[model samples]
Target: MNTPAALTLEAPAEHPFAPFVRILGKGKRGARNLTREEAREAMGMLLEDKVEDTQLGAFLMLLRHKEESAEEMAGFTEAVRERLTAPAIQVDIDWPTYAGKKRHLPWYLLAAKCLAQNGVRIFMHGGGAHTAGRLYSEQLLDALAIPLCRNWQSVNEALDTGNLAFMPLQDWAPHLQRMIDLRNTLGLRSPIHSLARILNPLGARCGLQSIFHPGYQSVHREASSLLGDNSIVIKGDGGEVEINPDTLSHLYGTTAGVGWDEEWPALSARRHVKPASLQPEHLLALWRGEVEDSYPQLALLSTMALALRGLGTPREQAFEQAQRFWDNRDTSI
Candidate 1:
């Protein structure tokens, strides 16, 4: 055989996160969403700090401006979960409370505590002070004397002692927390908020998430399905995983990889006003029987019912069970 001229095949150099940034920033005519795999790789680079800050900011804003797709959100969550040093725990529920409370007390904290008391091993994670004029979960939990765990071991230890444990995103996934903090600079929420809700670091059997925007309900549902997580995304109070008792809320999620959606009726007929002031003590005082409110009480039951249904309880039966738990809560505790 005649010796052919040697072919020179040079590999194209890959720039960290540049491919993804370009995919979203190709202008209106050419911009497109990243595939799931592309998103995963890009997010991996983000978590590893392999991308420049300029690229990170551009990528985030582009995604925000375009609106994140289900595949992209799933990929980001999966990438984060892959990097987590998750403790070996059979978590009954994964509750992400990053949205914080702007209008009301974090009654969801009380709901989680009630579920924990009822033997639901809840793994709650969130960030704090990321937004002005909002009451964060960590602050509210701290007010009630609930310890915020520093790491996986402490989380497991707390769950072993009591069915409840709250972990701040800063301790578990500092990289994502840093990105979340960029909200102040960016002046808008990013995809990080959506990804954090369904991170499910411990691979809990049930995930309870919330979205303030109604349009995100389908986005979260499809994303959870892509992650193979059995989760319920609800229009929660202040988007903090607690049901709004006054409004008919929509629910969406996956169960055993099958997608489902339902509309829940308003538990209370009267519309409740957002409080003039947020008192963290108000959460504890309500739980301790020193204070009482109809709205918070209904919110607690409805939210717990959703969590129960997420854990395989029958829909109507779950509500009944949740009501009993609420009625019998020991006020002194």
Candidate 2:
């Protein structure tokens, strides 16, 4: 965001990081680009609630105006990295950004749990509460009998046993967690919001994802394109990485220099499902730990599946990833 010269401060070392702050204050507003370490400091202030609401809003809007630079985004990822107990699952897989799942179906958690059950360990991040329209994800995990854990010890234990684990940002980054008030009062997303989606707290090497807004699709790709030649990305329900198979058409995915692929060949592409009332049903299923039922995602689910699966297989295979889960007797996948 807009780094104002007048707002400079000398942290106490006393203040944790005062000298660096003094130097940063000297940084030219327009000429300077934030470093990873500097970004972490910003995160500390944002997360700790040290930044005032107005300032926080300004930071976010300005940052967005300037466009969240690749370095800045990567730097911000540090806080997310520091905010979790490591995933304990022995099997390796990239855990997608399961941010803000309490808004609807705990899609990221479900996908994580399903993958975990199938021998994959997932690293999901989120513990934010602000908008009245949204609820905390921990509540959903609790409803499903899943422990909303706080550290590596508990997380690893859960992963080893139930193939699931939770690492709420509040526990790891209270500074960031406390920002809920900032967001609520400001009525806008802060720089932290952008940082939240790109989190990789578990040190996960890769993940299959469903992202929100096609505009952001490119950022996700650029952020993690180095992880693999076969990286997966989806247009999520709300910027998340899960897909609903009942709807969606061909997916759009790219690997930057790695090459982009479309023309999927996996599952049978079909018309969108149009039942009158399935949101409640899917919500109920989520709490009951029944993940097989497909939720009415307003086409987000279908779109994501097409995008992620279409990367490797044909459209049918990608679409089937969601369909197979819905039609199967076991929804654990």
Candidate 3:
């Protein structure tokens, strides 16, 4: 008699992405972080939309649980850089502003404006307001009058005219932006949040990153070093790259492929109270000299100093130069 039809078919072939998931979820004794090459391949596939939804979720969560290593971060960044279709705009600084402000205003914007006014070519990129109750950079773009670039041509023009520009993550890397959008679905931030900070898409000479969580400063530092990136990572106010003038801040970074750490003293003796409300107009007022708040002034100066330091100025000289930039600002806003 002929064999039953149920036994005639073969099982489906395993997904190529399955091995990556298995490598991460192979139980306590077997699971480990992906090597740099493996991470690059995995991220390459993810960016190409070759990974399934289930596999993507699993890989993100697994990596999130274990926390991504420096190798993984560097490798993932490499994959992203390879896919970026950036123009030949010469950028002096790569500033990634992912975290919006909750308690304090984004004093860092003023710092960037100050630098831009003095001819530092700054490229700032960020995501939309994924979380509630926080004021994102894009929301204040109109008030700040900073150019919002939609494409590389616009970015090139903005930099040439104003020495600064802001681009949204979705405009350049939609796949990574989609992963970030899954914050609500995943109930936690995926590694994309951190990886995006290190992308420096135009290959700027200096990169600045801010991490809110403890211990991530070192991760960024090491990852930047591995990528040969001259970068600074700090636990800044509200998780943006604005320094808090009320408390001492620790900066972790790499310069010329060498890792180093520094401590910047607080500008104020006591911590400043959080603002009752965050007003986007206040940023304009502060820049135009209509407002004279000591807290924000110190914040702007210190934040600019940090950026200057990243641009290779010595610590003392950076602080002095930042003060000069603030004092000599156009204040025409």
Candidate 4:
């Protein structure tokens, strides 16, 4: 085991991250979960930037390979929940979106439009290239011509107007945001990539998350089983809200009870519809109105409506509502 390093008063100073680091490096499968206090302390150290890069690097890898326990994930989530920026329209919208990023742009845009149109008010938070999810959202938005929102005011206005609003993750949490650098430097994702997705910037109860990375799916599911009280989770193309047309997308959420019709779309049913494809850049250029709607849009409208419960609308009824929006020409968010 490695000796305990001197910890600064940042993320996990009070916790025994060094021991976990040793255990992880040794290739041990599952050892023990971190206590709530320990997880909170580690997050504090991380936020304060007091943890050494080597130790921090090990910390992320340990979680990646060793996998954090649900209890530990809960503790970490609680700490994040404590340190987030409150939503612009906090008490107004019961369901605020903790947005996920995926390479496909049309799906999230459609989901956001459907959710907003159906009154599942959301505050979509994101950033640039931190992971696959955010990178895709950024790329698509660049092509779509949609405005990139910078602060709470713009997001608040959009949500209030029954449309989606966004805030970049880097702007929300700089310390956590900095972890993305390790990806390019190290040439692989670390645990911070996992935690970043589960972040609750607005501290809202409902979050719409994507499960893209297969390795982290279980980690995410375990975490949700612990801290998820009000959230909507779906299997997206790469973890955003958009379901792949070639695969069935399931809602693996612990929040809101799933109605009969809201169950995950079967692979057979999902693969049944093969919408025509267009070049990514070409589709994006037209998505922004730089061109026109010549590309077939990826569909996630039904999955989205199913996740939010449609404000008490019956599952089937909610689906119908989603269908209409999907078919509508003004479906751009």
Top TM-score prediction, candidate number:
3
User: Which ranges in model 3 have alpha carbons more than 4 Å from their true place?
Assistant: 1-6
Candidate 1 Cα RMSD after full superposition onto the native fold (Å):
5.4
| Tens digit of per-residue lDDT, candidate 1, span 150-217 | 98888998998888998999998999999999999999988898888988889899999898786988
Model 4: lDDT equals 0.57
Model 1, position 66, has a per-residue lDDT of 94
lDDT digits (tens) for residues 169-279 of candidate 4: 677677766776677776767656556666656655555566565645555655765664445555666555555655555555554333222454442333443334424
Better of 1 and 3 by TM-score: 3
Against the hidden true structure, what lDDT does model 2 obtain?
A: 0.52
Model 2: weakest 10-residue lDDT segment is: 259-268
Model 3 Cα lDDT, one tens digit per residue, 1-333: 988777577899999999999999999999999999999999999999999999999999999998999999999999999988997789999999998999988989989999999999999999999998988999988778899999999999999999999999999999999999999999998989999898999999899999889988899899999999899999999889999999999999898769999999888988888779987788888888887998999999999999899998998999999999999999885
User: Per-residue lDDT for 104 in model 4?
Assistant: 39
lDDT of 3 at 12: 100
**Positional deviation of 40 in candidate 3, in angstroms?**
0.1
Distance from true location, Cα of 210 in model 1, Å: 0.5
Alpha carbon lDDT at 62, candidate 3: 99
List clash counts for every candidate, in order: 0, 24, 0, 14
Residue-level lDDT of model 2, residues 47-121, one tens digit each, is: 556655556555665565555655566666665566444543452444434355433554555454444444445
Candidate 1 residue spans exceeding 4 A from truth: 1-14
